[model samples]
Target: MAERRMMLRDPGLQPERTRLAWSRTAFSLTLFGLLCFRGWCRDGNLFYGVSALISGVALTAMLAGWHQRHGKQFLSLSLWSVGALLLLNSLRQVLA
Candidate 1:
């Protein structure tokens, strides 16, 4: 009898690339939210500050989900929430 080692095959690189893309998107969104926060602090507009804060939190959750290879539902929900918050932020500006 001979001892043998079993190795798992590589699943290719596409998943890694997708994960990286998601991380980059989250990073960019976080930066944009920070800019909004700074503007809100300067001008005293609660809308910008609130929206940015919510978006930042959602983006952080999304990043965590992606990093952990969590279910798509969590990531999707966070992504959509971020988009909605950003939309509200823009509409508030236009309406003002």
Candidate 2:
């Protein structure tokens, strides 16, 4: 069986702050994706547009999972995945 990673009760204010920070990161990713999309539209580059769209979806999912109180493992996975996606997207835009 998979190891359980959830707590039975609230872990205090630190977790709340971390959760809020995750939401903020999600919001920032959404905004950055939009900006990238706009630039893609202007430049007629499919790569930029597609990467941004993926980032938006990833971040949105993270935010949703977070608010629903998904287990810490799930939250960590989603956050890291979104962060990596955004990082790769940024790198591709810069290097291409």
TM-score of each: 0.60, 0.55
Clashing residue pairs in candidate 1 are none
CA lDDT of each prediction against the hidden true structure: 0.71, 0.68
lDDT of 1 by residue, 9-31 (tens): 46788799887887787778788
Q: How far is candidate 1 from the true structure (C-alpha RMSD, Å)?
A: 7.2
lDDT string for model 2 (2-80, tens) is 3454444456887889878877877777787787688688987666676576666666667667445654565456446
Q: Which regions of candidate 1 fall more than 4 Å away from where they truly are?
A: 1-11, 66-96
Best by lDDT: 1
Whose TM-score is greatest here?
1
Q: After superposition on all CA atoms, what RMSD does each candidate show versus the true structure?
A: 7.2, 8.3
